[model samples]
Target: MGFLLVLGPLVTLHELGHYLVGRWCGVRADAFSIGFGKELFGITDKRGTRWKISALPLGGYVQFAGDMNPASQPSEEWLALPEQERAKTFQAQPLWQRALIVAAGPVTNLLIAIGILAAFNFAYGKLNIPPVIALVQEDSAAAKAGLDIGDRVIAVNGDPIESFDELRDIVVPNPGTDVDLTVEREGAQKEYSFTIPTLVEQDRFGNEFQVGRLGVGSSPGEIIAVGPVEAITLAFKQTGDIMVMMVQGVWQIITGRRPVDELGGPIKIAKYSGEQLSLGWRQFVSFAALISINLAFINLLPIPALDGGHLAFYAAEALRRKPASARSQEWAFRLGIAFVLSLMVFVTVNDVISLPIFGS
Candidate 1:
């Protein structure tokens, strides 16, 4: 139920983005579906678009006119339609229009996340903590880096640090990376260079993850109210920060700095959804916001059989002043589908192996 509750609305909103934009561009949609596989039930609207629920509840899509399938690959059948019908088909629309329709789904997901985060910022204010070190763990990264209690962190690398969070933002995503820390100690400014250490930790459910830790503590921070504009701005900043962490995490995995088994799929998502839901509404909604952003990021990858893939093709079309050859596009789509399926299988196996029952 938790998984469904979190993902259902997010997936629906994502497809709604494409459907509404397609309609606005004068392109007809054949179907709008939540989930995949055989339709469980549905109704065709006056415009002939079937709105339905499907058996698989993992993801959803908007099948536009001229689509060969829900991924929106062009269909040969549409080319044989009457002139008026062809004009209303997605494939026949202007390139810019088609691009807008395809891009809307992921863009909508991003907007939803920003909206949720902005609302939270406006409601609860922002945490403000000084960058003064109150405690440094013995023999930890901070101690080894020559950090002492009462030292005031002035900057990370070269960027000025005003709060503890800013300092952490730089360190956390960069585990094992050397950095120069500028601090004010007594009456002098000192610079220290050292590598941030990686700490392996587990949550209440014992799901393990690694993060960069400096092994320092600070006094409790205060929450200060922010105005609407500032709240929105801060929300965007927060979103960008999260995106950077995600990119770094991926890079770490690719570089072998992080283990491959850490890559999770649907099962991990379900586990997290349930865990967060049990915590409280606030935690659950925050998790939903994170997933929303993740959906947007994943869909925007420049891989075929995704919104990003279509956009990539459109970009190539824009450059060449024509679409790619039909045969090449078909083969590319086949390869993309295969890659996606293989990735799903690998991540599912990883998820199962990481489960408590499997001795993870």
Candidate 2:
């Protein structure tokens, strides 16, 4: 129920982008349906738009006026009409307007992410931690090197350490290698060189690896309240950071640098949603935000049967002063559908194999 509640809102917001933008462009929207298949309920609005709730709750659609067939084709009947009446048809609109309508879905998802992130930052303030030392493990590398608790680490290997995250980045990879640390203890500055011990640990992605273990923790810093403007600014930065990470992951996969075991599908997502739901609302919301971003990015890829594919076709038409041949367009759409279906099957199989159901 919670997952549906979360996913429904995001999906609705995405489709609403198409509906609203189509209406603004004077392209009549015949049916604004949430979900698919059998209609559970529907009503005509003042503008003669049929707002409907369908049986399938996964996603929805906006049917434009003069969509030739129930399958959403270009209507010859509408095209044969007088020029003035045909102006409201989707194909009749300028290419730029059509492109905008197509692009709006993914843009809405990004905007939704930014809004959610800003709200989260505003409510929670921000988690702040300093690079100051709190505890040094006994008989550890620090202890063997004459480093003690209460020593404030100012730099690592001559690089200024501003946050614990930065310090961890320096320490985690170079296991058993000595790193010079400049510290301030008892108001006196001193440099200590120590090597981090090697220990096997599992990462969040379920990959196990050996990494340096310092057996030290940082001191907590004061939480600072951010103004609305700062919060929004940081939110955008965070969003961009996440997008970068996602793109890198895709690149790694494509280059065979990352294992395919990390790939997941709808089953994995549903399992994750259920697991996160047990943890708390905030955790689930974070998961949803991440998934929403992924959806937006994937939909924008220039593949057939996708918004990007349509926009690409529109671009070609604009440049050549004519649309692609109908036969070519049909074949392209069919190929795209096959590719997407095959991908879905592959990911679904992977998900099932990785789950307890398959006992793998």
lDDT of 2: 0.78
Per-model lDDT:
0.90, 0.78
Model 1 Cα lDDT, one tens digit per residue, 267-292: 99999999999999999999999999
TM-score per model over all chains: 0.96, 0.75
RMSD of each: 1.5, 5.7
Off by over 4 Å in 1: 69-75
**Candidate 1 TM-score, true structure as reference:** 0.96
The TM-score obtained by model 2 is 0.75
* Per-residue alpha-carbon lDDT of candidate 2 for residues 1-360, written as tens digits (9 for 90 to 100): 655766788888888999889989998888988898999999998877899999977678888877664223466797687888678877778779989998999888888888888888888877677777788888777777777778788899898877776677667755666789898889998998777787768645453445677878777777778888988997887777677767766775677655565677777777777777777889888877877787778778888787778888888889999888877887888898789879888988888888765654
Residue pairs in candidate 2 whose N, alpha carbon or C atoms collide under 3 angstroms: none
